[model samples]
Target: MNATQRTNERPGIEKNRIIRIENGKKAYLPLLLLADEQEDMIDRYLERGEMFVLEDGDRALAGVVVSDEGDGVLEIKNLAVIPAHQKKGLGRRMIGFIADRYRDRFHTLLVGTGDSPMTVPFYEKCGFARSHVVKDFFLDNYDHPIIEDGVRLRDMIYFKKSI
Candidate 1:
């Protein structure tokens, strides 16, 4: 599938905008939940972190949340693209946007995701390298067992990319 890249101009597509949502971000809970799953778990970070929505024309295609982790580190707490919009490079574009948007303010961009066949490779493909893993992160943080791509996720794999 062909993906869109950021550039000065494009034809036949509405201008895409990434907007930082400062208040009432809870309205995108359904979209956010696609990434984090648990509402209470999301609540732990939602209020304190910053949220952004990717909008094209009148459609909101994806959402991401980030938080300052201090020490020149910025963490991608959650990222989710609507099911219908997945695999269209929107997610990667959001990542690239985040990188450019924060390159001056942060040294490293980190994301924690499940160790599943479906996820780790995607992050690696997005220029992120395996940094570390937190054992039992899913089991310890979530109230229920998490599984993806037919595999049970027991650890949280952390990936990092230097800006």
Candidate 2:
């Protein structure tokens, strides 16, 4: 795929552009950290995952990292939109782009995120269903407490969507 491509014509989403980052994935660390928090955890999959960024001219509005997890499964390791651009349908558009682009190659799209009120609903709204849970994922993996939407995160909630 090209490094940059125009998104499909969807009301309120046509103006955005999604770029595939072929190098320097670390350059977007600030945005990546918004979703995953810890750098080390992101490092675990950063090099292996394919990254795409939603941008408006020179500014990166959002980004996502997806890795093929074998057996026709593609996993979203990180996804984040800038605070100023959140809830504007950018993240949803990114997800839609990924699904459309990989529909032929992958059977399922998976994302494992903290059990936070803020994130789970967004995935659910984007057509993902609760698949499984890894208890104490935050406690066990993170060096510090991971909290979101006023809730202390403990488990890693996995969500799945069939492409």
Candidate 3:
């Protein structure tokens, strides 16, 4: 994997152009689960310095909310590729870009998820496997339960890869 260390320090909290998202806009509701009806917490993470955005072509296509737990663990708190662009390998391409850019630097990469059919499979297809599950994940962490197609979620799954 090719790794580039841009001498520039990463953007600062106030200068971050990327914002955290709890969900895509309303029209995208069917494609993802809204972690909360109110997006404040996610916004705060963005403002406090923990989110990363990926762009393809001229538009932003995906993001990953990450927290550095240790030099060995980089947690991908959230990840999504807009529904309009699914199934075209854009998601895979972005993941490859990020993994290539960070694999040698970080010992491992982690991704977490609440109960969601679409997201779980997407992660699996990207070469992730279930590492563990946290009960009441959404209840304990999110202000509201994530519901999609009227199904409520209460657990979160973790996926990991050695980069």
Predictions in order: lDDT:
0.89, 0.92, 0.61
Candidate 3: segments with Cα more than 4 A from true spot: 1-38, 47-51, 56-58
Best by TM-score: 2
- Residue lDDT tens for model 1, 89-156: 98999899899998999999999999887777779889999999899998888888887988878889
lDDT of 1 at 106: 98
Model 3 Cα shift for residue 73 (angstroms):
0.8
lDDT of 3 at 93: 64
- Steric collisions counted per model: 0, 0, 0
Native-referenced Cα lDDT, model 1: 0.89
Candidate 1 residue runs with Cα over 4 Å from true position: 1-14
| Model 3 clashing residue pairs (backbone) | none
The true-versus-predicted C-alpha distance at residue 95 of model 3, in Å, is 1.7
The number of the candidate with the highest lDDT is: 2
Candidate 2 wrongly placed segments (more than 4 Å): 1-15
C-alpha positional error of residue 135 in candidate 3 after TM-score superposition, expressed in Å: 0.9
Q: Is candidate 1 or candidate 2 better by lDDT?
A: 2
Which lDDT tens digits does candidate 3 get at residues 18-79?
43444433333322233334455455444433544554433556655566778677776545
Give candidate 1's TM-score. Answer: 0.89
Expressed as tens digits, the lDDT of each residue in 7-27 for candidate 2 is 532456444589899899999
